[model samples]
Target: MSQETASWVRDVLAGRAEPVEPRPAATVMLVREGADPGGLEVYLLRRVSSMPFAPGAHVFPGGSVDRRDIDHEVRWAGPAPAEWARRLGAAEPLARALVCAAVRETFEESGVLLAGASADEVVSDTRGADWEADRTALIDHSLSFAEFLDRRDLVLRSDLLRPWSQWITPLAEVRRYDTRFFAAVLPEGQQTRDVGGEADHVAWMRPAEAIEGWRSGAMAMLPPTVSSLKDLAAYATLPGVMAARRTIVPIQPELREVDGEVRLVVPEGVDYPL
Candidate 1:
């Protein structure tokens, strides 16, 4: 890491600088379906080593919520934002905002837009030029996600996102995310590209294959991503995979170092979905 980047990370770690608080972040696990049934894949991004957080780890496209994600003017579908908030044990208003942030971050990171007609109509012309700029502003606190959406008369397609799993970073980590994982089938005519500036590379791989690669030292994965991939390997089709989302449970693993190797301990007797 560069000296400047290392210094920033050290400040966050030493409490001299506060990394943003652990807020609701969203990750989209895109799966493709096929007749032969063996080609299913999920999108993965290898974050740049210079990143202060999770450098060099292959991870899903995601980031923290921004204040702009809460505009009531933004359109949405599926369960109400209030309901999602209740599920997450957060305030109703903030829950809605986080949902918007998740969708926006996924698009900004992967170049896969999830919003439909209504949301598109507003910024249909400017989306190409302004989307990334707006996203950058939100990340830097210069603008809000919802405000940016409203400026273009767009609405978030919350219906397209299905909650899969929830995980909180161990308290020991200086930077954390109270992340919610969602699954979506790769949309028709839309493809994922390596638009995430923070990522060094991107690829589509089967969950099992990714696990094998990580085991063989060809890939490096953070614990949460590894766990999610393991959970995904159980389903064969998009519909089947999404059906599993109905059983949502929060997983907060206790960090443990056993036999000189770090591991996350899921509580005994409690059935873990992943």
Candidate 2:
């Protein structure tokens, strides 16, 4: 931790400062099969340094929920909101909004849309001027997820996503998020483009390779991103990752004075890459 962060941690711990309430947010890890038979690769975006949160970090596509994310008019498929509520350990309303934000952010940041015309189908491609216009509208807040789905005559394919984990930003940080992490397979026929906005670079990399890059200081990632990459590295294929059941639990790292320096400490047995 930097000296400035350590000072903030000390202030917060000493009750000289109050921690900010974290905003609810969601992020998704998009995975796909690689050339190596059982190996998988993940989609990642290097956030531009100008970003307030995790600037210059290689992160998944996600952001905070907009008020309209809770719109009831959104078309849906797969699990019901009640089931999503149970899985996310949230009420039906917030659960629905989180899922909506996940799908919307995925489409907004990446070109991939996890929606289809019917319950069993998925959008094959999201290219061309029309799709770009809608995406831009959503980014600018002129278009809502519900309005976009309704206009496209599509339903959010919730079945394509699996709950991974929930992470809360540490109290000492100036900005915080009660963010949920989700795992998803890159839908067939859809491709990721160099969608320039918050991110400066995008790539499809093996989880282990990403980890190695972080270790070599070639890439920067937050704790949740590193932890998620570690989890993904355990799986050999996309199916293996999607098939594994996850018990969604919130992990909020604590600020501790370790050897005269303040550091973010995760739970025991959970590794935090230095």
Candidate 3:
């Protein structure tokens, strides 16, 4: 935590500061393999130490939804914006943006595209000079998502995504994000490249193994990551994990004092040692 953030947390816990507005954001957990505990793997990126939020913390690929993502011109497939809006608890436009951001950010950060020529297919290979150009443009915000998709004649594969959870940053933090989490099976033959910029390192980690790293103080994770890993640890396979219905809940943690120590408290029933 930053020094200012630590001070803000103290103040919030002391009831001396007001919470800030949380920005809408999206993130995805990409998994591959089957039912075996050892077989299940998730991609994680360690945000660069220079990042203002979650510096040096291991996280999935995601960011705040770009306003342009709501553009009606974006080539879209799968659920219509109205149905998606109802499902995500947002206006039609924002719901569209959230879904778009989920796919776009995944491609931007990890070099994997959750899009294809049609609803039934996924782009098997994202490696090429042309694809690299679009990726760079997307990162720089030089190209709008709709235009990018239009140029390639690709459709966003919203069906490939499964809603997982929603988490909000604690009031104590200077930067807050209301993030919607989604899960997807890493498309076969579409591998993640380092594509370093915001991240210093990347790896494939099992939920239980990742928790062990945190237990030994070898890696850092935010509360949502910690809790999500625990929830995921119970599942044996992607199909089982995705098929089970969940009542989507909004989890916004807060600062609390316990036993003379001040700590950020995530909601109850989150089983993490951290």
Per-residue alpha-carbon lDDT of candidate 3 for residues 153-223, written as tens digits (9 for 90 to 100)? 99999988888888888877778899988888899899999999999999988888998998888999988
Q: What TM-score would you give candidate 1 relative to the actual structure?
A: 0.78
lDDT at position 17, candidate 1:
74
Candidates by TM-score, descending order: 2, 3, 1
Q: Pick the candidate with the highest TM-score.
A: 2
lDDT of every predicted structure (CA atoms): 0.71, 0.91, 0.86
Ranking by lDDT: 2, 3, 1
**Ten consecutive residues with minimal summed lDDT in candidate 1?**
119-128
Question: How well is each residue in 41-114 modelled by candidate 1, as lDDT tens digits?
Answer: 88899999988888889998888776567778767866798888766566888778767767878777886656
> Candidate 3: deviation at residue 236, Å?
1.4
Error of 1 at 180 (Å): 1.1
TM-score (all chains, Cα) for each model: 0.78, 0.96, 0.93
- Colliding residue pairs in candidate 1: 68-144, 68-145, 68-146, 75-155, 119-154, 119-155
Clashing pairs in 2: none
